[model samples]
Target: MVWIPGGTFEMGSDEFEDSKPVHSVTVNGFWMDEHEVTNAQFAEFVKATGYITDAEKPLKPEDYPDVDPEKLKPGSAVFTPPTHPVSLDNPMLWWEYAYGANWKHPLGATSTIEGKDNEPVVQVSYNDAQAYASWAGKRLPTEAEWEIAARQGKPATIYYWGDSLKPKGQWPANIFQGDFPWQNTAEDGFTGVAPVKSFPPNAYGLYDMEGNVWEWCADFYRPDSYTKNAEINPKGPSSSFDPEEPGAVKRVQRGGSFLCSDQYCIRYKAGSRGKGEVSSGGNNLGFRCVKDK
Candidate 1:
């Protein structure tokens, strides 16, 4: 874990609607994981506690009463890129719900984590992340803490490293480098999720703070969260609300994923925000932990 010496920093960006109206925020110092939780770390937790992630558990019939009984199988959303150029408007073209896709089988039931223990574990829901944090005697970081840590005492810029996407003509983080969904040139040396610390660490020595995988945070997501005034150690809104999906409860997710691209989702920009349904897990989402200091 790295000691994040927290202080006041700009908390939002003008690049996105939800992150609009940039604001100031303050936070206290905390010990944060230097990198996202890896397959080895999570495997230890599961082996010790016999924990079952939400992706591995069968969906309760009562939870999806309207859905077909046969469809309520254990699985998660996997990023299945299209073979040809497709409209970016519909993400369903590239995202498919793969039955039996869980943290153990990142891509699907047939996929395995063998020899890839250093890679960040994906397909972990917000609830599953919380469970791992509890077992490790740590907690998910607040959105504020996460932002400041990612900033690394540097001024706000498009990329955590700086305004340039690639500093000195080298990929500083793992992000999509080619056409969205259809092709990934792997210019960053990674076509899929990169192993933790594969890229250079931020100024604060935190790895994968901007990419690799979307990280779960400890806050209820609200589109207008920045509008509310909680300058110091803001824990986010009291409740979750996404005008687009009001019925689904969501938690704040930070950092972006390997799928992020300039042609599509650019939430990897500094101060930008991401949110995910609490009960949902995906191949591009995972989390790290933080300890109070």
Candidate 2:
């Protein structure tokens, strides 16, 4: 864990509507994991407690009664891009709900993490992440703490490294490089989630703080929460709501993921906001932990 000597910094961004108003936030020091929690770490937690992640357990009919019972089998969302270009208007173009996909089988039943223990574990829901954090005697960072750590004293910069996405043609993090959701040039030396610490660390020595996977934060997401946030140590909104999808309650997600692209999802930016259904998990969603100091 790295000790982040947090202070006041401008949170959110003027570029995006949800991240608007550019509020100033103050955070206290905290000990943050240097990298996103890895497969090996999560495996130990599961082995110790004999725990099963949401993706590994059978999806209950009562939870999703509207969907086909056959489609409600144990599974998670996987990014299976189309062979040809598809419209970006629909997210289902590349997201396939693989019945056997879970943290153990990242891609599906046939996939394994035999030699990839250090890679960040994906297909974990907000509850799963919270469970792991609780077992580890740590907690997921609040949205403010996450932003403060990702900023690493460089609060106003667009990217963690700097304002430029790639300075001198050097990609500082793992992200989609090509036309987005269609072609990936692999310019960042990664086609999907790269191994933790595969890229340069932030100023505070936190690795994968901007990419690799969208990290779960300890906050119920509300699109307009920032407008009502406390000036100091704001946790998040009292409840979760997304105007675009008001039916689903969402938790905050940060950093972005390997699937994020400049042309499509520019959420890789330090100030960009991401959220997901509390019960939903995805191949590009994972989490890290933090301890209050």
Scored by CA lDDT, what does every candidate get? 0.93, 0.90
lDDT of each residue in 113-201, candidate 1, tens digit only = 99999999999999999999999999999999999999999977888889998889998888999999999999999989899999989
Candidate 2 per-residue lDDT over residues 1-293, each given as its tens digit: 99999799999988888887898899999999999999999999999999988888888899788988887788889999887888899999989989899999999888888999999999999999999999999999999999999988974777877989888889988889887687888999999988998987887999988878999999899888889999899999899989989888899999989988888888888788899998789989999999987
Models 1 onward score TM values of: 0.98, 0.97
**Which 10 successive residues of model 2 have the least lDDT summed?**
154-163
**lDDT at 145 for candidate 1?**
94
Candidate with best TM-score: 1
lDDT of 1: 0.93
Off by over 4 Å in 2: none
Clashing pairs in 1: none
RMSD of each: 0.9, 1.1
State the lDDT at 138 in candidate 1. 100
* lDDT of model number 2: 0.90
